[model samples]
Target chain A: MKDALLREIGKVVIPFIQIFGIYIILNGHLSPGGGFSGGTILGVSLIMHKLIEEPYKSRIKISERAVMQFTCVSLILYGLLKGYSFITGGGEFELLDIPLGIPGRILSGGMLLPLNVAVGIIVCFTIYTFYTLFDKGEI
Target chain B: MAAAANFPLLIILILFLSSFMMPVLKRVKAVKWLSLSSILLCVVLSVLTLAYVQQNGAFLYKVGHFEAPWGNELKIGYLEAIMSIMFTSIAALITWASFFSADYEIKEKNIMLYYTLCGMLLASLLGILYSNDIFNCFVFIELSSIAACGIVVVKDKKENIKAGVKYLILSSLGSGLVLMGIAFLYSITGNLNIGFIHQELVKVKDLYHNTLIISLGLFTVGLGVKSAMFPVHIWLPDAHTYAPSSSSALLSSLVLKAYILLYIKIIYRVFGIEIVKTLPILEIVLVMGAVGMIFGSILALLQKDLKRMIAYSSVAQIGYIFFGIGLGNILGLMAAIFHIISHALTKSALFLIAGNIIERIHSKEISRLKGIGIEMPITLGVFVVCALSMVGIPLFAGFNSKWNFALAIIDSNRILFIAVLVASSLLNALYYLPIIINAYFGEENTKDRVYMSKEKSLGALLPILILAFAIIYLGISSNGIIDLIAKSVSNL
Candidate 1:
C-alpha cells in the first residue's frame, strides 16, 4: 500500500477513470451505462487513491463532512424533483416543460439527465462514506 | 391542501422528505420534533383520507400520470385507509413516547439516525399499504426491512448488532422469496398491478394452475417469514427484545401487521377469495397458527427477561390474527381486523411501560419486578389493564376480539381451533397473571424499594396513558369497531 510505483500508477490512471465515469453519467440516457455504474467508477477511483497513497501524502482527500453534505443534498434534490413530477401528474421523464433535446445527445433526456447526475452524486458519496464507515467506525 | 386524491402520495412524500433531511439536521432535538410533527400531520391526513375514501369509495392514483395497468399506482380503499390511519396513529404515538425515553435508551450521537430509521420505516409501511403494484410492494418491503434493521442496530450493543444482522439475513431471504413470487406472477400474467393480475389470472386459471399454486406457496412462506408466522419466527424474539424499546413496540405492534395485511391483500385481491378457498394454503396457515398460539405462549412462559417474554407473546398474538384469517369468512376477517387495533394499542402500551420500568429500576428480569406496582402504580396499572386485555378477560379489548373470534368459528367445523383459542387464552393467563400477581401481592419487596417514584415523566407517561385509554375506549365501543370492520371486510 505504501509502494511509490503503485501510487504513481494510481495517479496516472485515476484521471482516466474519472473522465470515463463522467462520460457515462452524462451520456446515461443515450446508452446502457447510467448513474450507478458511472458513480461506482468514480467512487472506486477515490478508494484507490486512499489505498495506494500514504495517509499523510494524499493531496485530494474528501472530508466526511463534505461527503455527507453532498449525499444529503443530492438525494434531497432527487426526492424533490420526483415529488414535483408526481404532484404535477407528469412522468419522471418530464420534470419541467423543457423539450427533450435532440435524440442521442448528452442533453437529450430532460429531467432524466439531471436526475442521473443527482443519483450519480449520491452513489459516489454513499460509496465513499460506506468505505470510511466500514474501515474506521465513524463517518 | 390539495385534492383528496393527492393525500396518499403526499403522506409518502412528507415522510421520505423529512427522513432524508434528518442527517443534515445538527440538533437531535430538532430532528425529533420534526419527525413527530410530520408523523402527526400524516395522522391527520390519514384521517381525512379515511373520510374521503368513505365518501368517494375506492380510487386509484396513477403515479407519473401513467395508466394504471401499466404504471405504478396508489390504491386507496376502505381497507387501505383503515390501515393507513392505524399505522400513522401508532407511529405518532411511538415517536411521541420515544421523545422522553430516547435520551435514556439511545445514545446522543445516534438519536438522529434513530428517528430517521423510524421515519423511513413508517414511510415504507405506508408505501406497502397503498401500493397497488406487486413490484412496488416488494421494493417497499426491502426498504422497510433495512430501516427496521437500522433501528435495531442503532442501539450499538453487541447483541443488538447480532440481532439486527440475523434479522437482516432472514428478512432478505424472505424478500428474495417474495420477489421470486412476484416474478412468477408477472411471468404468467404479464402485469405487476394486483387488479390486472387478478383479471389475467382468472382468465387463464386452468392454463397455469401448477405455476399459480407454486407462486401462492412462495408468497405464503415469504410473508410468513416476514410476519414471523410460527415456525419461521426464529428471528422475532431477539430482534424485538434487543431493539430500543420504542423500536420494539413499533416492530411488534405495526410492522408485522403490515406484512399480514399485504398477504391478506394478495390472497383476497389478487388470487380472489374463491381461488384461495380451493387452495390448501389456508388450511396450512390454520394449523400452523394453532400450533404457534400454543407454542408461543409456552415460550413466553419460559422467558426470564420481561422484554423477551413480551416479544415471545407477540408470536402468539399474531397467531390469533392468522387463525381468524384462515376462517375464510367475513365475520372471521372482521374479528382479525379488530384484533389488529386492539393488539396494537395493548402491546405498544405494554412495551412503553416496560421500557419505563426498566429505566427506573434497572431491571429486565420478571422475577425482579416484585412490588414494582407499589412504586410505579400508574405504570403498572396500565400494564395490568393491557395484560388483562391480552389474557382475554371480559370487558376489555382482547375480550371483544376473542368473543368475535369464538363466534366466527363456533358454527364452522374447525372445533379444534376453538379449543386452540381457549387453550391459548388460558396459556396467556398462565404467563400474564403471575407477573401481575407478583407485582401486587408477592412480598419480595423491602420498604426502600416500594417508594422509589410515584410520578412518571410526562413524555413516557402520556403515550402509555393515551394507549391505555384507547384500549378501554375500544373495549367499550367494541360494537362500533366490529360494525366498521364488518363493513370493511364486506367491501373487500
Candidate 2:
C-alpha cells in the first residue's frame, strides 16, 4: 500500500480510469456500459487512491457522513424522478416532457441520462463506502 | 374519484421514497415520525382505494406509458384492495408500537436503519401484493426477502445474526426457485403477465403438461418455504425468536402472509383451477397442511421461549391457511383468505404483547412470566383475548377461521380432516392455556407481583389493544368479511 512505484503508477492511471467511467456513464443510453459498471470503475479508482496515498497526507478526503449524505441525496432524487415519470406516463399527462435529443447523441434519451447519472453517483459512493468500511472498519 | 386509482402506485412510491430519507435526517424523532406518518398516509390511501374498488370493480392500472403485455401493471381488485388495507393498517400499528420500544431493543444508531428497513419491507410487501406481472412480483419477492432479512439482523446481536443468516440463505433459495419457475413459465408461454400466461397456458395445456406441472411445483414449494409452510418452516422459529419484537410482529403477521397471497395468485390467477385440478398437487398440499397443523402445535408446546412458541403457532396457523387452499374448492380458498386476515390480526397482537412482556421483564422464558398479569394486567388481558382466539374459543376471530375451515372441509367431503382441526385446536390450547393460567392465577405465581407495575405506556399498548378489539370485532361480525372474501374468491 505504501510502495512508491505503485503510487506513482496510480497517480498516472487513476485520472484515466475516472474519465472513462464518466464517459461510460454519460453515454450509457447509447452504449453498453452504464451506471453500475462505470460507477464500479470509478469506485475502483477511488479505492486505489486510498490504498496508494498516505492516510494523512492525501489531498482529497471524503468523510463517512459526506458519503452517506451524497448517497441519500442521489437516491431521493432518483426516486422522485422515476416517480414523476411514472405518474406522468401512467396518467397520460403531457406535462413538462424532457425533449429527447437525436437518438445517437450523448445527451439523448430524455430522462434516462439523468437517471443514469444519479445511479452512477449512488453506486460510486456505495462502493467507496463498502471498501472503506471493509478496509478500516470505520467510514 | 379517478385519482383514487393511482393510490396503489402512490402508496408504494411514498414508502420507498420516505425510506431513503430516514438515513439522511439527523434527528431520530424526525425519522420515526416520517416513517409513521407516511405509513398512515398509505393506510388512508388504501382505504380510499378499497372504497373505490367497492363502488366500481377490479381494474388494472398501467405502470407507465406502455400497455399490459409490455409494461408492468398493478391489478387492484376486491382482494388486493382489502389486502392493501390490512397490510398498511397493521404495519402502521406496528410502527406506532415500535416508536416506544425500538429504542430499548435496538442500538441507538441502528434505530434509523431499522425504520428504513421496515419501510422498505412494507413497500416491497405491497409490491408483491399488487403486481400483476409475474416477473414484477419476482422482483418484489427478492426485495421483500432482503428487507425481511435486514429487519431480522438489525437487532445486531449474535443470535440475531445467526438466525438472520439462516433465514437469508433459505429465503434466497426460495426466491431462486421462484425465479426458475418464472423462467419455466416464460419459456413456455412467452409472457410474464399473469392474465396472458393464463391465456397462453389454456391454449397449450395439453402440449406442455409436464412443464406446467414442474412450474407449478416450483411455485408451491418456493412460496411454501417463504410462507413457513409445513416442512420448510425450520428457519422461522429462530429468526422470529431473535428479531426485535416489532420486527417479529411484522415478520409473523405481514411478511409471510404476502408470500402466501403471492402463492394464491400463482395458483388461482396464473394457473387457473381447471388446469390445477388435473394435477395431484392439491392432495399433497392437503396432506402437508394437515400434518403441519398437528406438528407445528406439538413443536410450539415444547419451546421454553415465549416468542419461539408463538412463531411455531404461526406455522400451525399457516397450516390452516394451506389446508383451505388444498381443499381445492371455493369455500376452502375463502377460508384461507379469511384466515390470512384473522391470523394477521391475532398473531401481530400476540407478538407485540410478547414484546411488551420482554421489554418489561427483560426475559423471554415462559417460566419467568409467572403472574405477569398481576404486574401488567392490561397487557396480559389482551394476551388472554389473543390466546383464546388462538384456541378457537367461540366468538373469537380464531374460532371463525376454524369454523370456516370445518365448513370448507365438510363441503369438500374431507370430514376426516375435521378431526385434525379439532386435534390441532386442542394442541393450540395445550400450549397457550398454560401461559395464561400461570400469568393470572396460582398462589406461587402471584405472591410477589405488584399491580400494574410492568405495564407499557398507554401509547405503546394502544396498538395492541386496537388489534385485540379488531379481533373481537371480527369475531362478532365476521359475516360481512366472509361475504367480502366470498366476493373476492368468486372474482378469482
Candidate 3:
C-alpha cells in the first residue's frame, strides 16, 4: 500500500468524510441523517484509513479493549437513561424539564440528541471492532 | 400484585443488562456468579409472577406509559408463567453445571463471552414468551437466533464454526420469511398488536380470506423452519452436535421450544382456535409430525457419535410435540405443553451426562465409551435414568406424556397415530437402551481403561442428579401436572 497517489488522496479525503459524519450526527434530530447513517459514514472513514496504511498502526492507536469499553459504556448509558425515564414514569419533557428549544434547532428533540450520539458511537465502534476481529481473531 | 405483574419486564431488563456487564467482570468466576445469581433471581420473580397471574387472572403490563394498542406490552398468563419458570430454571441448572466443565470445554478468554451469550439467550426467550406484539416477537426471535449462533461458535473449533455458519444462514432465511409473514399480517390487519390484529381479522374474516391463508402458510413455513420441524431440520443435527455440551443442552432443550411456543400462541391466541380448526394446516402438521418422529429416530439409530444420536433423537421428540398440536383437541394440546417440560428436563440431563462422559474419555463415539461408565457410575446412572424416561417407560415423565397423547387420539379417527407413537417408543428404546447396556456391560475387555475417570465434580454431578430426580418426580407426580396442564389448556 505504498502507492503515493492513493495515500495522498486518502489523507486529503478522510478528514472531510469524518467531519461530515460528525455534522450529520450532530444535526440528526433536525434533519434526515441520523445515528445509523452518520455512524456508518464515520466507520467508513476508519475503513479508508485501514486501506491506506498497511498495518494500520501509526495514525490509529485504539486498541480492541478501548473500543469495547467505549461501545459498552455508550450502550449502557443509553439503557440507563431510558430506564430512568421508565421508572420515573415521566414524559421526555417532564423527566429533563428542559425546554424543547426552537423547533428546528439541534436541541429540539429532547433526549434524542444524547441517544443519537450514543447510538452513533455504538454503530461506529461495532463496525471497526468487527474489522479488527476478522482481520485478526481478537476483539 | 401490581409490582409482581411487572416481573416480565424486569426479567428481560435484568438479563439483557447482565449480558453487557459480563465483559466488565473480566474474572471468570465473577462473570459466572453474576449470571447465575441474575438467573436465579429471575426464576424467583417468575414464580411470584406465575402465582400472581394464576390468582389474579391474565394481565397486560405496558412498556413505558403508552396504552396497550399504541405501545409494547407484556402479556402474562398461566402458560407464560409456567414457560418462564421452565426456561429460567433449566438455564440456571445448565449454567451451574457448565461452570465447572466450561474451563475444560472452552478457551480461557471466551468463557465470559459464553456466559454473556447465555444471558442474552435467556432474555430473548423470556421476551418471546412475554411479548404481546407480533413485531416485538419477531425482534426477540432474531435476537435469540444470533445469541444461539454465538453459543455454538464460541467453542472455537473448526467443526463448530462450520456448524455455526450453516445454522446462521438457514435460520436467517427462516427469520426473513417470518418477517415477510409478519408484514403480511400487519398490512392486512393494520395492527402490530396480536390482540388488535385478531380483533380486526375476526371482523374482516370474509373479505381477506385468501390473504389470511397466505399469511398462515408463511407463518407455518417460517416458524416450522426455525423450530427445526421435519424437512428443514438439516442444520440442527450439526449445530447441536458441534456446539459445547452445555450449549447443546440449551439449544436443544429450550431455544427450539421458544419458537414453538410463539407459533402456538400465534395460532391459538392470535388466530383463535375455531378459525384454525377450519384450516387444513393442522392435518398437514399431523402428517409431518408422524413422519418426523419415525425418520428422526431411525436416523438416530444410525449415528455412532453420541451427540449426533441425541441430536437426532431431539428431532423425533420435537415431532411428538408437533403431533400433539396437530391433534386439535384439548387433551392433545395438554400433552404438547407437558411434553415440552418433560423433554426439556430429560434432554438437558442427557446432554449434560454426555458431556460428563465425553469429558472423561475425550471421545464422542458411543462405541469408545464402553466400560467408562464403571469409572463414572453416577453420571452413567443418570444417563440410564434419563434414557428410561426417553423410552417412555412407565413412571418416567416421557411415559405420561406419551400416554396422554395415546388417550387423546384413542377415540378419534387418528388412532393410527397411537400405533405410531408406540412404535416410536420402541424405536427410541432400540437406539438408547443399547447405549446404556454398552456403557455398563460392554467395557470388561477393553484396553483403553486409562481414559476412565474415577471421580466426577460436584458441580457437574449436582445438576445431573437434580434433573434426573426431577424427571422421576415428574413421572410419579404426573397426575398433578396433568391437572395443571388441563387448566392451562382450558384457559387457552
The digit string of per-residue lDDT tens for model 3 on B1-492 reads 666866788788889888788876668899999999999999999999988987898877777767778888778888898899999999999999998779989998899889989999999999999999999999999999999999999999999999999999989988888899889888888999999989988888778777777787788888888888888899999999999999999999999999999988988888887877777888888888888999999999999999999999999999999998888888888889999999999999998888888887789998887776667888888898899999999889999889888987884568779889988999999999888787667536344553336558776699999999999999999877677677777776
Identify the superior model by lDDT, candidate 1 or candidate 2.
2
- State the lDDT at B95 in candidate 2: 97
Runs of candidate 3 with Cα error greater than 4 angstroms are: A3-16, A53-59, A86-108, A130-139, B442-452
Q: How far off is residue B108 in model 2, in Å? A: 0.6
The lDDT of each candidate is: 0.87, 0.93, 0.86
Better of 2 and 3 by lDDT: 2
Better of 1 and 3 by DockQ: 1
Tens digits of lDDT, candidate 2, B1-492? 988888899999999999999999999999999999999999999999999999988999888888999998999999999999999999999999999989999999899999999999999999999999999999999999999999999989999999999999999999999999999999999999999999999999999999988998999899999999999999999999999999999999999999999989998999999999998888888999999999999999999999999999999999999999999999899999999999999999999999999988899999999999899999999999999999999889999999999999999998999999999999999999999999999999999788998887899999999999999999999998888888889897
Clashing pairs in 1: none
Native contacts recovered, in order, as a fraction for each?
0.46, 0.60, 0.15
Candidate 1 local lDDT, B52-117, one digit each (tens): 887888888888767887678988888888889889998999999999888998899889989988
**Candidate 3 or 2, higher DockQ:** 2
Which candidate should be chosen as best, given TM-score against the real structure? 2
Note the DockQ of each predicted structure.
0.50, 0.75, 0.32
